[model samples]
Every structure is written in C-alpha cells, then in structure tokens.
Target: MAKCPEDLLLSGCFSSVALIMIKAPAPMLIAVGMYLPFDTTFAVFVGGMLKLASDKFLIKRNADEKQKTIVENIGILVASGFIAGEALTGVLLAALVLLGIPSITSLLTGQNAFEFTGSAMGGWLSILIFGIVILGLIRIPLGALKNKVQ
Candidate 1:
C-alpha cells in the first residue's frame, strides 16, 4: 500500500539515519579520532556548528530539492536523508578501494600484507596508512552521496 519508498517503515528509518551521517562525517571523524585536547561534550557542539555552516553552504548553492517539506523541516529529517543517500556512496567507495588495492582480495580473506612481516612498525604502519587512505577514498563517495540524497 506504500505509494513510494518514503511510506515504508524500515526503508524510511535507514534512509533517515544515513542522511545524518552523510551530512557531517568529517566532523564526526575529527571528534572520534582526535581528542582535541578539550571537553568531550564540546565535540557535539563543534559538530553542530560545522553542520550549521554546511547547511548554509548547501542552501546558498541552490540545490535541487525533490521535496519542499524536507527543506523546511531542517534538523533531523533533512539530516537523515543525507545520511541515507551517503550509504550508497560509502558502498561505491568500498568497491573502488577493492579494485584499486592489489592485495584487497587477500586482506578480505584474512591474509596478511607482505610489508606486514618486516617489523612491528611495518605492520602497525600498514594499518595506519590503510586507514588514512580509506578515509581519502571515501571523500569522493561522500560528496556524491550528499548530492544523491539532497
């Protein structure tokens, strides 16, 4: 009986949650990865401000909105839509990474890296570099995802 995906409960919920993440993942990464040498509660506050600025940029650009109701609602509803759309971007980024990395197939299957055997630092550095590269890889998908949801 649903007219569109918006009417379905599970689809709606997941999509909504994705919108939130899609909107401000960088702020989130910073909050989680860096201590910022200050009060942790301030992290949320900082994220909010960054998002506020993002929202303005989004608005100033004159983005095409399928639904007017969503623009007016702001806050949670709009945020969720962005996150939901970004989930697809995240998936795409993962795919691109797998294609780009020669050892991806082995890594996924639990085979360790060649450089990993060199030293303790080698293994540790590989993991660290991998994480950093993954973040960089995700940036494009995140941008694409933002456009899709919005």
Candidate 2:
C-alpha cells in the first residue's frame, strides 16, 4: 500500500511549514531558511534589510532614472556574487568529502568555529562582519555614482 504524502506530513509528527518547504535544490532551501537553522535565515533577513536601506539612500538622493538603474544593477551584481560564492563553497566542501578529507570543517576552522559561541566577543565579531557586508552592498553602487560624477 502506498502512503499519502499529506497523511505522512500532517500526522502531528511534522510541522505544517516543514511539510510544505522545498525538498529539492537544498542549497536554496537552506539559504532561505526553509530547511536549515535559524542563523542562515537571520542572515538572509538582514541582507534584505541592507537592500532596503540601499534603496532608501538612492531615493533620498533623488537619483534619476539612469542612476536608479545603476544602483539596482550594483545590488543585483552583489547578490549574484553571494549566490556564486555559496555554490562554489558547497562544491568545494562536497569535493572534499568525496575525496575523504578528514575533519574538513575542523581543518577549515581549527574546530573553533562551533565552540566560540554565546560570548559577547563572538556576538560583536558577528555584528562587525555583518555591518561590513551591508555597508559594502550600499557603498559599491554609491561609489560608482561618484565616479560617474567625476
């Protein structure tokens, strides 16, 4: 006898959202926080906020049609870079696993990445990194605009 997907999904064992979340294209599902931990979801949310702030800056400056186009293009370029980077990283990690790389995560992080948690120092470091990336997203296009004026 075949089991129904909905029966399995809604049997009070799995949450409704989890049942509906995408299963294929795991990377995207993880990136969007549908099938992964909250940290990634939080990061993605913050990136959206950064884009919002960047758009606001452009509006505040009264950017013309061409300027608006340039800013939007820069945002797209940055987002593309992020997606490419994630894909490359995933491929590299997969290859390492296929090649029997020992303790790959530890090798990359000296096993400290997971241990350095719940500390103010770690929290501050995370904030600093997040700020830098967000600022870069905002500044790169603004810099381009400045160059155009020169």
Candidate 3:
C-alpha cells in the first residue's frame, strides 16, 4: 500500500514510509494495527531529546539508574549518527546532482540508482516497476551463481 503524499511532507522522515513499503510490511502493519505510528528517526530523536530535557525539568524524577543512563547515552549517540549520516548523504547528493546523474535516493528505498517509468504508468506505478527491476537485479545474479554450482 502507498503512503499518501501528505504524510511524506509532514514528517520529513521517510524511513517507516519506505521501509513499510519496499523493505518490510508486517511489522509496520502490526504497529499500525495497534494504532501507534512507528517512530521515525525524527520522532525518535525528538523523543530522546525530550526524554533528557524532561528529565532535567522535573526535580522529582529519580536519579538516572544504570540501565536508563546507558539507554539515554546510546540514544544521544544514535541521534548524532543519524544526523551525521544525513549530512553526508546530502553532500553526496549535491555532487551527484552536479554530475547530472539521476542519483536521488527514492523515498521507498535508500539506494542510489536510476528508476524506470513506463510511458503509460502513473508515478506510483513507476515505483512498483522500479521495485520489480531491483528485485530482478538482485535475483538474477544469485540464479546465475546457483546454475554454476549445479
């Protein structure tokens, strides 16, 4: 199932939207089934920041337990990694754009590759076609190797 365009614009995070599509659906469906949207990287980062800030705000909050401290520290580090990775990807994107390669990462998959769209297909249809192409490219090499082994 496709995510409506508005969700993409509002969140500024496409991980669940794309992963719910091209990568995994069952977990996403289960999350949606529970009426809780999966926390995107943005949401998680916000939550992590708030977790720390809110902890600071409340004087009554208990002293940070060992496990909680580990978790919060890890959260901060993970958030930093996500920020760094995004910056690096943007720099790479600018380089690719300058070279005139159609190198945009699809919101559906974080890969850099050319996408195909048939003349008659709508935009969403083109993405489905692109997924099939990606699957084939992945499988054909495996198939060839299997034949050689046989």
Residue-pair clashes per candidate, as listed?
9, 0, 0
What candidate 3 gets wrong by more than 4 Å, as runs, is 1-64, 104-150
Task: lDDT winner between 1 and 2, please give it.
Answer: 2
TM-score between candidate 2 and the true structure: 0.61
lDDT (CA) per prediction: 0.54, 0.73, 0.53
Top candidate, metric TM-score: 2
Q: Against the hidden true structure, what lDDT does model 1 obtain?
A: 0.54
RMSD vs true structure, all candidates: 15.1, 7.4, 18.6
Candidate 2 — worst ten consecutive residues by lDDT sum?
22-31
lDDT (tens digit, per residue) of candidate 2 on 6-111: 8655553454345456444444434346555788677777777876887788789887889888877887898789779979989988987888764466777756
Q: Write the per-residue lDDT of candidate 3 for residues 1-150, one digit (tens) a residue.
A: 976888645553455566567767355543443444554443444444556553563334353454345445544565466568779999988887787756555533666444444345557785686466444433443344344445
Task: Kindly report which residue pairs in candidate 1 clash with one another.
Answer: 16-80, 18-83, 18-84, 19-79, 19-80, 19-82, 19-83, 19-84, 20-79
Question: What's the lDDT of the predicted structure labeled candidate 2?
Answer: 0.73
| Candidates 1 and 3, the one with greater TM-score | 3
Which 10 consecutive positions of candidate 3 have the poorest summed lDDT?
137-146
Q: Using lDDT as the measure, which candidate wins? A: 2
